[model samples]
Target: MMTKHELRREYLDRRRALTDIEVQESSLQIANKVLELDIWSFSNYHVFLPIQKQKEINTQYLLHILQGKDKNIVVSKSNFEDISMSHYLLTDQTKLRINSHGIPEPDQNGIPIDEKNIDVVFVPLVIADRFGNRVGYGKGFYDRFLKKCRPDVIKIGLSMFEPLESKIDMHVNDVGLNYILYGEEVIDLG
Candidate 1:
């Protein structure tokens, strides 16, 4: 089995190789797949804005869906110093700017939403396995952020490709995802 580091590098290369059209189309498909989930009854939904340069999933489509559903959307601003993220409510007046790392974040803090209030989180990842083990950018930002959320918080990973047949390495501190959305498939890990 490939290590998490190896899987991260491999999947990063694969994602970078995707064309812009592929990314957008796959992201839309994944977003549509999310509709099948029973998570719509939640209020505060935390989602990650994609890192465009890395060819990550275009979460803009998913954001549109959330907006249409009238759910309270929450986005995060990352603190590189502590490797932690501060959650904020994304409002119509919230201005977004790309940070130094190419992540689109709120230019200024909006309504602060505590992690415990988040009912569902749309997590970003390089790749994930059948068991919901994910390989991200090695930042541990989401793991740390998710750790602080309520134990019942729904954690969903968005991916373009299907999960790997083999499980990736897992750490004691790593938080597993509840489900993974890829293409038109939803892999339920719970």
Candidate 2:
């Protein structure tokens, strides 16, 4: 088995090879397509913006609509890479921070979560399988968070590439995605 360090390195290397223009164009296209979907138009959604060096999407624009700030504006927070959870209420001002391990802990004011209110959640992944299994940074933060969330919550995995057919070792606690969105396609995991 590869060490965690090696796995991380390989993941980072592959991610870094993607150029800025390519990442931007692909992410924008995917985000646009998602917005055009009926599900996005009809539901309350929470999206997690990626950190630097990872594929960056135009989350701020989406946030504006969800937060009711402006239809055409995109808002992003500072100190994003250091912020835990990177969790902010799409409908409120509250932010939840995530630690280095990817575990989200409510901030001092507590995370304002409306369990039944959330319709969709966009997640980040290093890699994913056709079976809906995702290999995150290996920290299990998203996995743990998903466990505490409502089962009906739509779990969407956002990736820059298509799903890999190879087996990715997953534990029992690992969360499965309901949908996987890639630059090339959007797959329904149901």
RMSD of each: 0.8, 5.5
In candidate 1, stretches whose alpha carbon ends up further than 4 angstroms from where it belongs are none
Candidate 1 C-alpha lDDT tens digits along 1-190: 7888888889899998999999989999998999999998899999899999999999888889999999999999999999999989999999999999999998655889999999999999999989998999998999999999999999999987899888788999999999999996999888
C-alpha TM-score for every candidate: 0.98, 0.71
lDDT of 2 by residue, 75-147 (tens): 1232335422333343345454554534333354534455445567777787777878887776676776666
List lDDT for all candidates, in order: 0.92, 0.62
Instruction: Return the TM-score for candidate 2, rounded to 2 decimals.
Output: 0.71
Q: Could you tell me the lDDT of residue 79 within candidate 2?
A: 35
Would you list the clashing residue pairs of candidate 1?
Answer: none
